[model samples]
Structure formats: structure tokens, C-alpha cells
Target: MTIKHKITLYSSLFFSGFYALIALFIVMSFASFRAEEFKERLNEKALTTIRLLLDVKELDNDLLKIIDQNSIHQLYDEKTLIFDENFNLIYSSLDDTKIHWTTGDLEILKTEGAYFKSEGENEIYGIKHLNNGKQFYAIVSANDNYGKSKLRYLTTIVIITFLVFLLATWLFTFTLIKKQLKPLDEFHENISQINDLHIERQLATKENSKNEIDLLSIEFNQMMSRITEVYNLQKDFTAHVSHELRTPLLKLSAQVENQLLQQKGENDLFLKSMMQDIAQLNELINSLLLLTKNNQTNPREYESIRIDEVLYAAFEKISHDFKDISIDFSIAESVAETPEILEVKASPNLLEIAFSNLIKNAYLYSDNKKVQVKIYKDNHKLKLSIINAGSKIADKAEDILFKPFKRGENTADSKGLGIGLTIVKRILTNFDFSIEYTFGSYTHQFLIIF
Candidate 1:
């Protein structure tokens, strides 16, 4: 799970457990208080019964029973049994319902002076009475309906309150966590868009807030500032070096051409080879310059251009250099019917360079010095494929085919630098395009998806 979800879940669980414990404590404490209070009420009832029966001159058992039956203060299901010193029943509040008691119980009540206990849902209280120098035992039992009802009501309230608070806690935590982490989500999205072409871009930060997230943004901006500085310096160095070397290379090429015109036989052949070497060196320098120039290409310069036009341009350039090489180019019926299907949004110059490199590679490595180019639509996206019948590249070599200065095992006799595919990959990636190399049915294929 994400950090936001984990934090919210754990926090809500913690608060829920804490609240449940507090609710349990409240119910237990209130129940304890109610039990003690009811016990005291029962004790008071027993003492008053004993005093009224023995101490009052005018009140008799029958009159006292009538008073108890009509008393407003009488508890629910109240029953009382009075025993003399000899353990004989003398008084009972309820005539129909008998109070369960034994001789041993009366003796224990006499010795202890007072007792309180619970019998099922009823509370039992016993007391020893002393009047006119005579001992009497009294036992009473009753159910505290009012107190039990209050407890039940309180328990229900606590449960309902706990449920409501738990729901509130989960919702509040989810919303709060999502709100707090919104900045981080934006940071991830913005950072993912940063590339070597856009190295100068930086994350925005709040000026007044020093919270952890804001601090992270500030630090990220500072780091990007330093990286952009270093990147610019490196780019400047490469451009300057390439520019400075071009002048000497041009001079050397002019000298070689002049010598080739004046030489004869063996001397002419040697000068011709030297001229080829000079041309190769000049091509390398131009490639380096072009690579640097592509990095500095402005996104505003990109526009919708016909892919076939770029392909034809690249083919003409390659055909001029390799007169004997032939290429078979075709467009799918569906794509040919809709000219716009072959159009893509990119820098025209960069696309030509990428296409030229792939076409040249296909021509150079083909067994018959022939290349086949096809354009079609796949899954609603435009795709171009350059196929050649050549020695298949190993799986291990395919992985590094687009890495700088890396060549395939099949390119041992090829007369070109290894950065062509690398340059193509960089240009396509800048335009959010992709390329893949695959070999099947004795043919090598380079597929570009736009």
C-alpha cells in the first residue's frame, strides 16, 4: 500500500481502539456505582422494616405490610423476611413470593451484623437489628429495575457514539492525508518530465512554509540548478571542441584532394585512400556537431511533417553516396488512402537524420545491398519499419545497440561510427517516440512507433 493509505489506516485504528477502551471503562465504572448504590438502598429498606415492626407501639405486622405494599419508595420485586433470635420467621413484606433463606443464613447475618450480595438479577441485603436488648435478623431482596434500565441506555449510547466516531475518524483521516500529500504527487509528475533537454527546469516551492514537503521542493530546485550548470558547461565544451577541430580537418581534406590530382599510378592510389580517410574523419566531426545541435533543438520548432517526405529525402541522400544500393519503399493501402496517417509531429531535420541513419544501416548490412521500408498504422499509431536480410544480431548485442560508441557483432566490417543509432534514439525519445529491433524469418527489422 501507499504511505498515505498506511498512515491513515494505522491512525484510525489507534484512535478507534483508544475510544473503545474509554467506552468500556465508562460503562464498567457506572455499572459498579449503580450496584453499590442499589445495595445501600436495599440495606436502608431492611433497617427501616425492623425498626417499624419492633420499636413502633401502634404499628403491627398487618399494618406494616399494608404500608410497605403501598409505599412509593418500595423497590421492584421487593421481598423481606424477618427472623427472631431463635431463627423463626416473623415478618415478610410479600405474602405470595417467598424470600429464600435458611437457618444458617440467619445465623450468619446475626454474626456478621450486615451482608450484601447478588442473586441472579436481584440484589440481596441482610442486617442484624438490636432493640430492647434483643437481637433480630432481617433479609431483603429486590431488583434495581430503574438503575439497570439507565445502565442499558448508557451502554447503547456509548456503542452508538463509538460507531459514529469510528466512521468519522476513517473519513477525516483519508481526506486529510490525501490533501497533505498532494504536493508530493505533483512533485513526482513534474520530476518525471525532466530530461537532458529540459535540465534547467526546477520545481516550485512555497516561500513562507518550511514544512518537510516544502523543504524537499526547495532542495530539489537547488540541486537542479547545479545540474543545469554542469550540463551547460559540458555541452559548451563539446561544441567548442567540434568547432575548433573542423577547420584543421577541412584544410587536410583540401590538401589531400590537391595531392590526388597531381599524383599518378601508386601515388594516385595512396592519395585516393588518404582522401577517403580524410572524408571519414570529416564525417565523424559532422556527426558530433549534429548530435550537439540536436540537444539544443527548441520544442517550438517542431511541426507536423509528412513521414514519407522525410523518408524520401533520407533515401536520396543515401542513394547519392552508395550508387549501387537499392531500396524498396511502400505504404500500406489504409495509410496511403489517408495521407495524414503518415504525418507526425517532430523536428523535420531531426526526423531526417534518424531516418537516414536507419536506412543507411539497413543498406550497409543487407546481403544483397538492398533495403525495404514500409509504413503502416498499428493500434491507431503510425509505425515505420526498415527491413534488411542480413546476419542476425545476438540478443545480448541488441540491448546495447543504441548505447553510445557500442556496435553489434555484425558491424565488424562496417565503415561508420557506432553513435548513429544512439543519436536516432535520443531524437525519437525527445519527441516521445519509440524504436525496437527484432529479427525473424531471416530478416532484421528496425521498427519506429510515432
Candidate 2:
């Protein structure tokens, strides 16, 4: 997962656990308060029942039951019992529900002077009452239905509120984290676009912002500045060396050619071989010069050049070099009628160099000195494939096919430096194109997707 998502998830979980504890505390505290409050109400009922039975001369158990049955403040399933000093039953409430009590319970109530407890779903409150020198025990039992209903309602509200707040916390955390990391996202996008050709480019930074991401951008810019300076120095050195050697090499080649024309002996063959060696050395210098020039060239200077014309130009040059080589070129029928379909925006010279290298490599390595070049539309994009029948490349050699100074295992007999595919790949990649190699049926294929 991305940093944004992970931060949001962890933050939300922490807040959820914290809020859940708070909700539990609130519900439990309220429940405890309700239980104590209901017990007080039961105790008040028991004392009032004992007072009416003892102090009022006209009051009787039968009349008190009528009063309790009609009282507006009556509790649900309320029951009351009274006992004389001798532990004889004196009064009972109208309800048939029995208030279970053992002698030990009554004795404890007498000793303590008052008591409160729970019997199943009912609360029981007891008190020792003394009136006119006579002692009496009063007990009351009832279910606090109203208080319990209030507790259930409060519990439901707490649960609902907890859920709503949890959702809000998650959403707020997600938004805040995404907003805080926006600069990092932009940094990744900008850094991905930097390459050796654009090594001087620097990431943009916000003024007066001192966050870690902004600090990273500043450090990266400083690092790239040092790298660009070193890269430019090296590039200038290589170009200067290559340029200084070219004049002497050209003059030596001219001298050798003149000598070969005049001499007619075994020395002529040796001089001719020397000329060939000079030519190969010249080609290597030229390839290096091309690479340096490509890096220096601005991409904006490229123009719309026809792809077919570039191929034909490259083919003409390859055929002159390899007298026995031939190429079969074809365009798919879907785009053959439209000449504009073959046009691409690129540097004509650089693209020609890339295609020429590929075509030359194809002809040089083919068994029959023949290559097939085809152009077609794939997924609405232009694609070109150059195929040659030859020994298949080994699996281990496939990965290094486009690396400089690297060649396939089957290319030991080929007469060229190993930097051709590397140059081709660099040029194509600069133009936002891609190339891949595939082998099947003893044919080596290089596919270029534009």
C-alpha cells in the first residue's frame, strides 16, 4: 500500500480503539448510576410502607394494598413485606409475586439496620424500622423497568454515535494524509522524467517551505548540479579526443590507399588489410561522436519525417556496404493507402542512423544475406519489425543484446563493433519509441513500437 493509505488506516484504527473505550466508560458509568438511583427509590418505598402500618390508627393491610394498587408512582412488579419484632408476618403487598427471604437475610438486615441487593431481575431493599418501642423489618422488591429502558436507549445512542464518529475520523484522516503527501507525489513524477540527456534539469521547490519532502527536493537538485558538471566535463573530453584523432587517421588512410594502388606484391595485401583496420577504427570513433552529438541535440529541433523514406535511405547505405545483401520491405494494407501514416516526428539524421545500424546488423548476421522489413499498425500505433533467419541467440545473451560492447553468443563471426543495437536503442528511446527482440523458427526479430 502507499504511504497515504497506510497512514490513514493506522490513524483511524487508533482513534477507533480510543473512542470505543470512552463509549464503554460512558455506558458503564450511566448503568452504575441507574442501579444506585433505582435502589434508593426502592428503599424509600419500603420505609413509607412501614410508617403507614405503624403510625396510622385507621390504616390496615387491606386498605394499604388498595392505595398501592392505585398510586400513580407505583413500580413494575412491586412487592412489599413487613414483620413484627417476633419475626411474625404482619403485612404483605397486593401482588401475588413472592419476595423470597431467609431468616439469615432478615437477621443481617436487622443487624445492619438497612440492606440492598438484586434477586434475579428485581431489586430488593430492606430496613429495620422502630416505632413506639416496637421493632419491625420492612422489605420491598421491584423491577426498575423505566430506568432500564432509559439505560437501553442511552446505550443505543452511544453505539450509534461511536459508529458515526469512527466513519468521520477515517474520512478526515484519509483527506489530511493525502493532502500532506501531495508534494511527494509530484516529486516522484518530476524525478522520473530526468535522464542523462536532461541531466541539468532540477526539481521545483516551494520557497519558505521546510518540510522533509521539500528538503529532499533541495538535496536532489544540489546532487544533480554536481553530476551535470562532471558529465559535461567528461563529454567535452571525449569529443575533443575523438576530433583530434580523426584528422590523423584520415590522412593515414589516404596514404595507405595510394600505396596499395602503386604496389603490386604481397605488401599490397598487407596494406589493404591495414586500410581495413583503419576503416574499422574510424567507424568506432564516428559512433562515439554520434552518441555525443545526440546528447547535445535538442529534441525540439526534430521535424516530421516520413518513416518509409528513412528506411529506404538506411537500406540504400546498407546495400552499398554489403554487396550481396537484399531487403524485402512491405507495409500493411490498412495504412498503405495513406502516406501520412508513415510520418513521425523525429530527428531525420539520428533516426536514419538507428535504422541503418539495425538493417546492417540484420544483413551481416543472416544465413542467406537477406532481411525482411515490415510496417503495420498495432493497437493504433505504428510498429516496425526487422527479421532475419539465423542461429537463435542463447537465453543468457538475450538480456545484453542492447548493451554497449556486448554481443550475443552467435555473433562471434559477425564483423562489426557490438555498439550498434545499443545506439539504436538509445536513439529510439529518446524519441519515445521502444524496441524488443524475439526469436522463433530460427529467425531473429527486432520489433520497434512507436
Candidate 3:
């Protein structure tokens, strides 16, 4: 899951737990208050019943019973009974649901003035009443059915409200989090678009914001500025040094060759070796100059060209330079008659340079001085490959093979500057192409997919 989803899930859980506790507390508090309120109402009914029983002298048993049953206010399922000090019944408000009382219960009511007891769902309240020093007890009991029904309804409302609120909170939190992290999403997109070709471009920041994302953008821009400064300086130095050194190196090689031609003595071998060294140095200088151009060249210089024609030109050049090497070249029969398959948009000079490097590497490292070149179309993509019979590249070279100054085990027996493949890869990347290296049991292959 993404960070936004994780944050939303955790925040929903946290808020749900918090709201659940609040709902529970509300329910418990309301239940307690309702129970206490019912108890108070029962006690008040008992007091009122006793007051009428004691103060009304003309009130007979039937009249008192009638008044208790019909006129006395009571809660749902209410019942009442009155008893004298002698434990004889005076009046009963209920016909079937009786409030059973023992002498000890009456004693408690007489001593304490009021007594309360609960039997199952029924709540009973008893009070002692006195008239002319005569003692009587009045008792009331009920289940508070109306209050219980109200509480059930309230409980359902609380539960539904809690669920609705939880859902609303989760949606609101998810939306708010997505809005808040929008900057990070944009930052990631911008970072993905950055490459060495656009190294000088800076990350954008809000003008008046000092948030962490804004600060991060500021730091990234500063870092890119430093990298661009260093990269430009390196490119300039390489180009200038190569241009300056190539002339002297070529002059030195020419003078040494002339000396060897004229003398032809014991020092002839030494002069030839010195001339070879100068030639290798000159090659390195030229490769460095190409590298600088690859780094600084603009993509607008590219135009439509036949990739097959460029490959043939590079192959011919390598063939003329190294006649001892033999190369087998072929075009796939499927595309033999298809001229459009050979066309691609790229810089022909850069393409030829890259192909030349690959051809040279194949020639220098092949054990039998033989290479195979193939061009084909696979799955609507143009595929080109150069295979050479050579020692397999070392496993460690897979990661750093395209890096500058990185060579493989096969290059140990070859004369090279270790930047041939690196330059080839850099040149291809500018044209939206890439190179792949594959090792077979007896052949090394460089595959280019366009």
C-alpha cells in the first residue's frame, strides 16, 4: 500500500477508537441517570401515597384502595401496598403483582425512614409514615418500561450516529491527507524527469512557503547547481586538454617514424615502440574528445537516416583498418525487402561513431579475429547485434561495463582506453536507444534495441 493509504487506515482506526469510547461513556452515563431518575420517581410515589393514607381520616379501606388504584400517579407496570406497624395489610394497588415484604424489611424501613430493594427487573421503594405516633409503611415497585423503551431508541441512535461519523471522518481524513501530500507527489515526478542532460535545471519551490517540501526543493536546487558547475568544468577541461595534446602527440609520432625511416639501425625497434605508444596516446585523446562532445551535444542535430547504411559504413571503415579480421554481416530475410525498417531518427555521425567503437571492440577482443553482425525487426522494434568469438566477460563487469574507465576481463589482452563501450552507450542514450550485453558459452554479444 502507498503512504497515503497507510496513513488513512491508521488515522481512521485511531479516530474510531476515540469515538467508540465517547459513545460508550455517553451510553453508560445515560443509563445511570435513567436508573436514578426512576428510583426517585418511585420514592416520590411512596411518599404521596403515605401522606393521603395518614392525613385523610374519613378515608375508608375501599375508598383508600380505590384512590390508590385509580388516582395515584405511577410509572409503567407500577404497584403499591400499605402496611401498619402490626404487619397487617392496609391497601393494595395491584391485583396480581404483589410487593412481598418481611418484618425485617419493615423494620429497616421504620428505622431508616426509607428502604429500597431490587428483585429481578423490578425496583421497590419502601418508606415509613407516622400519624399520632402510629407507624405505617408504604411501598412502591415498577420496571420503568417507558424509560427503558426510550433508552433502547437512544442507544440505536447513538450507534448509528457513531457509524456515520466514523465513515465521514475516514473520508475527510483521506481527502485531507491526499491534498496535503500533493507537493510530495509533484516532487517525485520532477525528480524522475531529471537526468545528466538536464542537470542544470532546478527544482521549483513555492515563493512564500517555508514548509519542509519547499525546503527540500531549495536544497535539491542548490545540490544540482553544484553538480552542474562541476560537470561543466570537467567537460571543458577534457575538451581543451584533448585538443591541445592531440597536435603534439601526432607530431611526435610523425618525427619518430621519419627518424626510423632514415636511420634503420639498432635503435629502430625502440623508435617503432615509441611511435606505437604515441599512436595509442593519440587514440586516447581522440576518444576523450568524442566523450566531451557526447556530453555537450544537442539533440536537435539529429535527422532521419538509414541505420543499416550507417552500420555498413562503420563496418567498412573497421574492415579497411584491420584486414586480418573477418566479419560476417546479414540482414534478416523478413526485412530484406522492407526499406522502411532500416530508417530511424538519429545523428548519423554519432551513430557511426558508436558502431565503430563496437566494431573495434569486437575485433580487438575476438580470439579468432572473427565477428558476426545481424540486423532484424522483432515485435515491431528494430534489433541490431554484434557478436564476437571471445572469452566471456567477467560476472563483475555486468554492472560497471558501461561506466567510464571500466573494462572487462576480455579487455586484459587488448589495447584500449576502457571507455569504448561507455562512449557507445552515452551516444546511443541521446537518441533514445540502449545497448545490452550478453555472454554465451563461446561468444560475447552486444545487443542494441531501438
Q: Which candidate achieves the best TM-score against the true structure?
A: 2
- Model 3 C-alpha RMSD vs. true structure (Å) is 6.2
Tens-place lDDT per residue, model 3, 313-385, is: 9988998999898889999988788878888878888899999999888889888899899999898888999
Q: For model 3, what is the error of residue 77's alpha carbon versus the real structure, in angstroms, after optimal superposition?
A: 9.9
What is the TM-score ranking, best to worst? Answer: 2, 1, 3
Candidate 2 local distance difference test against the native: 0.89
What TM-score would you give candidate 1 relative to the actual structure?
0.68
Of 2 and 3, the candidate ranking higher by TM-score: 2
TM-scores of all predicted structures: 0.68, 0.78, 0.65
Q: Could you arrange the candidates by lDDT from highest to lowest? A: 2, 1, 3
TM-score for candidate 3, residues paired by index:
0.65
What are the lDDT scores of the predictions, listed in order? 0.87, 0.89, 0.84
What C-alpha lDDT does candidate 3 achieve relative to the native structure?
A: 0.84
Poorest 10 consecutive residues by lDDT, candidate 2: 292-301
Better of 2 and 3 by lDDT: 2
For model 2, residues 1-450, the per-residue Cα lDDT tens digits are 987899999999999999999999999999999988988888788888888888887988899999887878799999999999888889999989889998887898779998888899898988898888989998899999999999999999999999999999999999999898999999999999787666788999988888999999999999999998988888888889999999999999999999988888989879988998999999999887766653635555678788999998998988888799889999999879877889888888889999999998888889998999999998989999999999877887898988888887777776678889988988987888899999999999999998
Model 1, 283-311: lDDT tens per residue?
77777776666364555566889999999
